[model samples]
Target chain A: MSPWAWVLAAYGCAALLVGGYVWRLWCRYRHVSRVRLGEADG
Target chain B: MRPFAVGATAALLSVGLFLALWVSPPDSYQGEYVRILYVHVPAALAAYGAAAVACGASALYLWRRDLRWDFVGRAGAELAALFSGLTLLTGMLWGKPVWGVWWAWDARLVTTAVLFLLYVGCLLVRDLADDPERGRRLSAAVAVLAFLDVPVVHYSVVWFRTLHQGPSISLQGVKLAPEFLLPLAVNTLAYLALLGVLLAERARLASLEVER
Candidate 1:
């Protein structure tokens, strides 16, 4: 592969990992908060 | 996490990407592939910092028996896993082109991979335990022990022969050029900001688990 290809791959992987992590954190946080809210209401 | 922190992470990362890709000159030896150093080094160091946080927080939990400390410990461990995983992946991406192999059994590489697995096992020990209190305490202890590898990973290049190079930026001095160092510093700050925000968010989620 070309040097630029390697650089792009590295950066792209970093972006995906960081973005995917934030997404998962938001999902887990929202799910837990929703559960607590349901318990509080009920 | 707070809105201000969220904003800072985005802003810093955006600027970081701009500088790393554009402002930083290609290395004389490695050419464009050296760009990988920006992401790889920052994430690796951040992983080390995160593991240290895990170690410290877990020790506090053991001393005070506070779930709050456990929450932070969990956050630190999880982020340590994430950042270290990124470090390994980026390292491989850089390695394939440079080293002519995707993986190596070198000391630096092996030690870093071990650090990743140790934290991962530290996390698994928590969830796999039969009792909640036992799980918490066990994981905390695991985190403490897992941290012993961090220093070894940091010094692996210096301590043993390896395909990986020694530290470019160290207490002694920076070996990198000014142009390269500037983008690297910026990206490292961005990754650290992201780490702080994620740590707070994950810890809050752990707290909310208690509320429910």
Candidate 2:
């Protein structure tokens, strides 16, 4: 593999994984917040 | 995570990446394969730090029987797994070009892989138990035990003959050149910052799950 290929692969994967985890957290928090909001209204 | 922390993490990571890829010259020995070390080393550091947090938090949970500590413990274990996974992946990326193999049976590599799996098991133990309280207690113990592999992983190169290189930066002083060390130091702080942000956010999310 080229140097850029190796570097890009490593950095790209790191960025994507971290971004994905953060997105998952955001989704979960929103989900729970919605449930709490519904419960509050009910 | 708080806005300031989130911003700081992004800034540090951006600057660190630039320094790693652009500013730091290629290694005379390893050439461009050296760039992988920039990310690989920091990920390992962050992984070990997360495991330590998990161990400490787990012990706290055991002592105080506090759900808050459990939240941190769970977050720590999860981050440990994530970073360890990255460490292994990036290590392989570096290794294929340098070591000529995607995987090795070396002690450092094997122990690190074990550390990753053990923390993963720590996470699972909590959900698998019949009682929540029992699960917490059991997982707390598991987390503490899983942390034992961390030191073994760290010293594995010194303790056993391995493909992995010896410690570059340690109490004995850094072996990395100034150019390499600067970005590595920056990336280390960046990863630590990222670790803090993720840990707090994950713990907060865990709290919300219980709260709702």
Candidate 3:
């Protein structure tokens, strides 16, 4: 594989993994907020 | 609430990324691989900055028995750990090609790896402590001691290194051409500002959690 291809692939994979993690983190934050709000109302 | 702080951080990051990636000239030696400098070096510096904050906060907590300082210590410690992990990952990726191996037992690499592990251990300690107060104090003590390595990690190359370049743009004073310096400086500033904001947010969350 070309050097550019290797670099792109490595970065792309890392971005995907880190992006998924950030999404999960955001999801968890949302879930916590919703749960907290529900508790406040109940 | 702090619009100015948020705006400054965003702007810094934007400019930093732009300059580091596009403006900086390719390294005479490394070519495009030099681009890794924008991320790896900044992350490393940010990690050390966070760790230093953790150390200072840890000391304050120990001396005053203040929970607030402990909170700062914990929050910064978490961030430092995250950045340290990123630095190591990027370093390895950059290393494999340059050094011909992904892993090395050189002094700089070894010390940095140890530092990262120490922070990870700290995270576990905080989680394992049953009482918040007790946990914070204990973790603070640990953080203060562990941070001694911060200087060693920073100077590892100068002091003793198995493999790793010496200080580049930071101390060399305009060692990087405009293309690289602009983005690198911007990114470094952005990462630092981001670190501060994240620590503040984490501290706020911890305060609220405790109140609850």
TM-score of chain B of 1: 0.89
lDDT of 3 at B105: 53
Best model number under DockQ: 1
Predicted structure 3: lDDT: 0.71
Reference-based TM-score, model 1: 0.89
Q: What's the distance in Å from true for residue B147, model 2?
A: 0.9
Pairs clashing in candidate 2? none
Candidate number 1, chain A TM-score: 0.75
Write down the worst ten-residue block by lDDT for model 3 chain B. B165-174
DockQ of 1: 0.83
DockQ of each: 0.83, 0.78, 0.27
Per-candidate TM-score against the hidden true structure = 0.89, 0.90, 0.80
Error of 3 at B119 (Å): 0.5
Error of 3 at B166 (Å): 14
| Per-residue C-alpha lDDT of model 1 across residues B1-212, encoded as one tens digit per residue | 39989998899998999998888888876678778989998998889889999999999999999999999999999889889999999989977876677876555566678889998999899989999899999999999998976676657655554245553322123268888888999999998998888888889888987877
RMSD of 1: 3.6
RMSD of each: 3.6, 3.5, 4.2
